[model samples]
Target chain A: MTGLNNKIHQALQQIHAEQALKDKTKAALKQKIQQYEKQKYKTEKRRLVAILACLCLLLIGGAGWFYFTPATTISIDINPSLEVGVNFFDRVVSVESYNDDGQELAASLDIRFMTYAQAIQEILETENITDLLSADEILTISVIGSDEQRCRRILSDIESYTAGQKNIYCYSAASDEVATAHEIGLSYGKYRAFLELQSLDPDITPEELQHMTMREIRDLIDSLSGNKQNENASDTHQGAGNGHGQNSGGGNRRQGR
Target chain B: MRSEQEVNKAIERYADTVRRLCMIYLKNETDTEDIFQTVFLKYVVSSVSFENEEHEKAWLIRVTINACKDVLKRFFRSHTISLNELMEQPEILEPDHTEVLEAVLSLPLKYKDVVYLHYYEGYTAPQISRILRKNVNTVYTLLTRSRQLLKEKLGGDGLE
Candidate 1:
């Protein structure tokens, strides 16, 4: 029995030794291959990277022209009043100021819009706006809703019609209704009409109203009513028929044109 | 200087990856050595640089696997060994454990590759896809089929 136990122990030891040999051989062979690769690789591939670096630099330099081209500097080079006097019909819808090196520094707008009167009694006392057709200071504006919710449909019209195979970038006055009402230059009626019509739009929010530029609202309302060029006729017609079933005839006219 | 030193250390760290990949393809020590050299040589030749140590480790593992396949194809045409003999050689180390490992080795090469990478090398099915350039679904299917075969090779009454 002791001899049999001894034999079993010997067999186990032999198995363990064989396993150790198997593992070592496998590990050594892998190490030797890695050593050979490490020795040859460094010597062979040294110059490849410098060449790649140079190629990368050339590509980046070529791309910088688009990223860093001087912005189109379209400012009022003289006093805007003088520029306007010299070119009256130019209308100077947008003014872009430039730096000494001709990079666009800032953009300003000097388009004509209505003079606003305060709303009736409460509009006059609480918020006294004297010259309804007057100038207001503006920093920046866009044709999209100020909060990025909805835009005047006329933006698409301008892109499709006005841009017409030409790719020049300009800040347009959007639709005829907005521009015409803006140019009418009287505040109370336009503002009142804007409030009345704005209330009628299903999706209009007071937040959208507060952020809206006079020009953007004018464009949106006019485009919705469908007479950008005929704001005076439409505003008067809308005012006269407001809140009565009498406007039902005009509702038919809305679909007619 | 620190990054370069880290990269070299990272290559040394993923040494098991090269071993398991070689073990899946080649039967003997000499063939494993050849595969190891080829995989690292690929790492040296690759123009793509990595962001950190982890990236370098992953690239080393993937390159080793491809090199192992290439070496096996180049060799199998010239030298043929029975699958049973190849599977039995590792028995000298652990006769008790040889059943599972041998069953794995006897699987078809597509199933064997996915099993080895998934189990021994610790790659997830998604990582296996990038390494083998196979779809993720294909790797999952191969793994499931291979496991079923292994269960059968173990020869139990489970498949009723």
Candidate 2:
């Protein structure tokens, strides 16, 4: 048995793998490894591209949101009650109307993306607005914002530009007050007039006042409060022009020069 | 993936053992070449870390045997070859050694691994059982039957 085992071992020892076979296998394995590395690289590159594309989409969408979001609102009320939304850059981003006449006026104006000053100028120069001004109608411009300093700057700029015009009142109010005004479907100007009238008459409704001009609402408030001196006055009334217009309904009234 | 240096070392060390196992199972040079590539390629891609040289040798032996069986199971290929093509340089083998090798190769497929491992590789029945994943008693029975068969093929005198 030992001799048989030794002979089997000796015979097996004589058999060695040729050098050519080992070389061929090493060459083949090297080629396969290269292919594997290339495939891995391509897969990683594809993943990186997908991530970059998603980031780019998020950046574009965020910029669009930043450019279009409103930071301050200017409510213009003179029978046709409407509001213009201004972005952080002071550009008018939206115009919304609360009545049929305001809708018609809004449709006739293309003030989007314009500066608030330009938009207000365009509104005052419109034929309908010019005709109303000539007939002694009151146009109230209310600047609503969270930032008091920014609102005051805007109100000062507006008062200076409309200094020569008659019966155009400019003031600023807090955003919370404007939000309350919007809940009842009234622009901030008409809402202040409504508050004044409500305090005097206690029966004046927003619906009853929606179609009335700012001049008419002021006359109603003056008539109910028995302050008849300001009635039929064609001069402008500037409401304190303080960025915080909390007392704008009664205590803030000032005769315009 | 194994490094190039590691793969070269394994080929140098285990190439003879793999070639001998290939001779035990396959009857042709092409099949032996196929088994060589298949076994070495598996070693290259395998993440198995061995504790020592014995563990690696056992793994290579098992893989070479399985690769041989897989080639044989392919129904499309022929398994027959002339006796001259059986050994790759038959001139080096003495007449007595050639007779002994031919006798071992002619053994039944189930007995070939047991005879080679027990006689030439010096593995006991229990160790062969562990390598082949078989019952220790079953390995002893196979070794007994293979010893009897080898004795009959060669002369019974001086045969264990």
Task: Give each model's whole-structure lDDT.
Answer: 0.42, 0.80
Prediction 2 TM-score vs. true: 0.73
In model 2, the number of clashes is 0
Q: What stretches of model 2 exceed 4 Å from their correct place?
A: A1-10, A144-166, A169-184, A188-210, A219-257, B1-6, B17-22, B25-84, B88-160
Winning candidate number (DockQ) = 2
Chain A TM-score values, per prediction = 0.20, 0.83
> RMSD of model 1, in Å?
21.2
- Candidate 2, residue B32: Cα displacement in angstroms equals 4.7
* Model 1: lDDT to the true structure: 0.42
Instruction: Residues B70-104, candidate 1: write the lDDT tens digits.
Output: 77787672222244654466643345444454565
Tens-digit lDDT track for model 2 on B1-160? 7876788799889987887888778877678777887898899889999999999998998899889888988844444333466555664355557777777877878888888888878889998998899899999999999888888888766664
Against the true structure, what is each candidate's TM-score? 0.35, 0.73
Question: What's the count of clashing pairs in each model shown?
Answer: 14, 0
Which docking band does candidate 1 fall into? incorrect
Against the native complex, each candidate's DockQ, computed on alpha carbons, is 0.04, 0.48
